[model samples]
Target: MIRPGLTFKLSILLACIGVLASGATGYYTYRANRTMLVNEAGQSLLTSTELLGQRFSAAIDDVGADALVLASLPSTANVVQTDNGLGANAPREQLAQVYASFMVHHPEDLQIRLITRKHYGLELIRFDRDADGLMRVEGNSLQEKGQFAYVFDTLAFSPGRIYTSPITVNHEYGTHAAEGKPTLRLGTPIADASGTVVGVVIIDIDLAGLLNRLQSDLPSDYRFYLANEWGDFLVHPDASKTFGFDKGRRVLMQDSFSATKPLFDQATSEVLLNGLVQPGQAAGQVLAFVRRPFGSSEGSRFIVLGLARPLQDVLSGATQLGNRIIRMVLIFSVLALFLAILFARALTKPLHILAYAATHLFAEHAMETLPLKRTDEIGILARCFDRLRREIKSQMDVLHNKQRELVHLATHDGLTGLPNRMLFMQKIEAAIAEATRREEGLAVLFVDLDRFKQINDQFGHSIGDKVLAAVAHRLTQVLCSADVAARLGGDEFIVLIEGPRSAEAAPGIASRIIGALNEELLIDGHSMTVGASIGISQFPDDGATAEELLLNADAAMYAAKSDGRCAYLRYRDVIEARKLKREQASEGATEGREAEPTA
Candidate 1:
């Protein structure tokens, strides 16, 4: 037999082994898949960045050339000439037409603006076309053109330079908007034949439009943003319209551009001219970045274009794969548990069968030896059980006989073989319930042999017991089929008579009991005569509960002794009244004794 403790330990060890094996396999599979996914995503991001950079550079070059052409037209001498030459009465109307025409021609360029340097201000010219297909320019004054004083001052100092440069400038055109819209202004210096800088030609493209184009080419889950040297957002695809120059208005560079910022800043510092750098310092940080120095070739303004991809994304993919693997493992675990339980049951089947057979062997008292057919461990157990069965059977026979003797002793008197007090009480309680249900009367008779103590004192207790047994036999013989008789120890006995109609009927059963006791009893080779006084009480009318009825019957038995020695009496209200009077008399006597206790 396997010990219960050992079986439990083995089952737990097996389950743990299964879980550990599944978990380890799941983790490794998840990690491998995740690494591959992140690599793919990084490669795709780098490819898209290259494509977007080419498109953005091309658009910037086109806008720069267009701004230079419009700035040299001599029509921009004043707001009125700029407006009339562009064929619009208002500067804003002329500029709006110029911009509208530009948007129509270059539909991919979402916004186009021409900025001029005059009186330390930027005049915003937009291209518009009339019904005649004639191109017009509208000049709009920038309110915060003072903020861009550095741009004009730098261009004025070196007018010989006329290559593309990236400048971080603040907008002043729209007063209804916020104070400053920071932008990456791509410009080239416009100079005279003598190589003296007259003014800078600026193309004020929408920074957000450029970023939107860049981000749209990337994956849906990834974030893309562009920030200038000051760590301010030139363009943020998520919250684009709110980009500006106030400290509070600056975009959170640490949030959207966090993963790529260090690499971008490093690239900005390294390449004073156009060049490429690795994504990070480590071998794992090998993302490609291209830096194009912005502003004129000989100018103060320089801007770097940064592109990066992190291996952390690969790690994230691996984590997701690990979760999936865990789910699969959990599914397999449930299957394993079910199969393990089935296998365990199969292994324990013989034991279960043996247990059932053992239970039946004891219950049915089978005398045959255990049937051990095989030579396995189970057969050895069966052989052991068979030996155990024979030993138990031998003891069982002795126990059965002893038990029978005890049952007889419990329910019958040792001397009389009549029902004892315990059995009598059980029968009486049952009779009371039956009588109440039938609305009939049950009579409880408390019978005491009269002058029985005289017999015991004159003769020995052996003779006394003989007399008592003879009386018990006589009572049982006289009892009706619906009646019970029991000895209450010594010379006292009780009888329960059910199906009686009234208390009046109780006297007849009691009288029969007394008359039977009056007959001569042969005990110890002598004929002796004894009388019995039986007191009877009826159910429901005499007492509601069992204890009360038995108590009343006992009191009536004493009353029978007081009335005379050898008759029976039925319990009545007078008996209870007499008991009450005796109690009162006893109380009065107690009080009088207390008062007179001085001596």
Candidate 2:
């Protein structure tokens, strides 16, 4: 309220008028500067996150390349073949020294193991750093590790590709980490000449060392964190939060930085959260995260790498500028604030829009083009956000496509492009349900090449693979559209003939498959003639379920091989009669084989 003094009211009016203009100008400038500074801070955070990911990616890639080369050595393959040979001692020693040399050269590596699958996975050669940091090769100390997911899981993948393990406390006794040093493993499969998985080469990485490398050469203020796919912190500034599972309690990154919880839910590979991150964290923690996906056909999903720092450090300069602007504004008359608050809303409008858009982008995985018309720094920030949204979407699409491909590759056979046993079993189970519901007859045909081993011996497995592919194509052509054909591995194949055909027609279908394979195949300029012996088993007649049907069909197929080289056999209820017939047929087959000349 103005004083009754006419001159005082007039003077206050003049002051208000002048301050309103100045306040409006100062407020706009303050907001524009603040937004720009925050934008720059965000950009710096993103850059640091990206640099961390790239550096770590490059380092792991180099390690993986080295692992591949080491796994490819001839002695590595021989180790699997000569596991039981008396002469293996020398070769094993050489491998141990070779791995020891690797650990010596790379002290950050906790252990290097060339392990083969034998009962529980067998360690053919293992070299690990002791608690004293000395690289030691254990020869007679080979232990069974088949139970570890790292050992068996890596065996499922093809050679040359690297598989990474989740970071955890090292549990194996008598090594560098026996005291529970944090560990991670990089594993690559060892393949024989025919591309068969013979063993796996695993390099144990020191997680503490990895964190040091990730933080190397960076500013003293910079901090790095690592987490597994589930967002459980694996590496943290406070070591106690890391691998909390080992302590029987789970402490998650999402729990600390609740803002990033949506990232994992959205399956995004990268994200950045600004503001207070966790309880007890500095009031202005800015955390940026990037996911490092690693696994075989199965997913342990990703290892999240993050770089975090105090936002106060980044905004210190901006804060100083803001204080100067505040001091300038305080010189204004009190009435000016009434108008400034009303006008400040319009200036901060863009900030709210940008914040809303960023939140929506991650939470909903949907986007609307931001208001990009302004020629100010806010507009530039909006443009960057919009671009990031587009890029994240593009990356997610690619990630989804790759995930689908991995799923397909996991279930399908690599050589013949047919469904492998895993997929085949699923289809058979489904087909059995359908048959049971409709009371329709179903057939399971087990087809085995009569002399596939002979073919492999005569003309390397390369030709054998080609022959198998050709046979797969022929089987697809002979079977009905409703039928499912799968390679049960090696030279054996199984087909689930669903509806569109009766059990009586199974023998005919099997015969047709046999006839199709009987034709000469020109594989790699070698005219090859191979015969198939297929056995037919009907659902509810020979067996009730998928496993039972497949088992019966397999037994019947051997009977077909015994009856004649190229023929089909049907499962019957009388096991003894079928056994007698197979025995007599085997005798005849022996006599026939005796008549052939070896040359």
lDDT of each: 0.60, 0.78
- Among these predicted structures, which one has the highest lDDT? 2
What does candidate 2's lDDT look like per residue over 135-242, in tens digits?
554545678778889888889888877888877788776665535887878888899899999788988888678768677887788787787778888888897888
What's model 2's lDDT at 548?
Answer: 95
Worst 10 residues of 1 by lDDT: 270-279
Q: What's the number of clashes in each of the models?
A: 19, 1
Model 2 has an lDDT value of: 0.78
Model 1 deviation from the true structure expressed as Cα RMSD, one decimal place: 20.7
Regions of model 1 farther than 4 Å from truth: 1-349, 358-371, 389-434, 500-505, 573-599
Looking at model 2, residue 501 earns an lDDT score of 70
Deviation of model 1 at 204, angstroms: 34
| lDDT for each residue of candidate 1 in 433-497, tens digit (9 for 90 to 100) | 88778888877889999978988888889899888878877887887766777887888888877
